[model samples]
Target: MARAPKTPPIPPDARAVLGRFETRGPVRSRPMFGGHGVWCDDRFVAIVFRGVLYLKVDGETRPLFEAAGCSPFRMSADRPSRLAFYTLPAGVNAGSDDLEPWLDRALDAAST
Candidate 1:
């Protein structure tokens, strides 16, 4: 049998996070597997899970995130799978101006 549809609206916290990207272009979210996928101008750039935002990272940007003490998004503690997304450094709010640089990088990475 097919799984039931997930049509729950984006949580308030997720909306607040995505709001920061609105200036970049059209920002939208879609619920997926208990989290929300964030898109900017139709480009998939980030994910909000458990209220934490993770931005897409490529080889060029992964080092930047790592140097900033960010960790990759793992499926679970028991799983070794790691995605290309990484969280911002501790205390960096998703809506803060500090996200400008990182956000630009993530958008660039997503474009590729």
Candidate 2:
């Protein structure tokens, strides 16, 4: 019997986007589609794709993301697949060190 090839591990740069969660709890970054699935404990909280970190959101906080000019994550579907996650704004990405609030929001949505 032949053994299957083992999948390559995710690169350090690709997974660096999830470093913030290390201190909070155990964070797992597994490859998903073209991105990585970020999980906090047992809940899916965020995703990192092409250097963009998207956080989970619910109906209540969706408007906030919109107001911040952050777009919801879209995937392939029969129509359009709008996921419950949104990208952080450019300003937030431009040297803004605080990500706790965003992480909090993601955890809240994932918890529910």
lDDT of each: 0.80, 0.72
Q: What residue runs in model 1 are displaced by over 4 Å at the alpha carbon? A: 1-14
Each candidate structure's TM-score, on Cα atoms with residue i matched to residue i, is 0.82, 0.74
True lDDT of residue 7, candidate 1: 49
Give the alpha carbon lDDT tens digit for every residue of 1-112 in model 2.
9985554554564356456666667988787767678898778988766656788899877787788888777764345456688987656642357556776777788888
Best by TM-score: 1
- Cα error, candidate 1, residue 64 (Å): 0.3
Clashing pairs in 2: none
Q: Given candidate 2, what's the lDDT at residue 99?
A: 56
Off by over 4 Å in 2: 1-17, 76-79, 94-98
TM-score of model number 2: 0.74
Error of 1 at 88 (Å): 0.9
lDDT of 2: 0.72
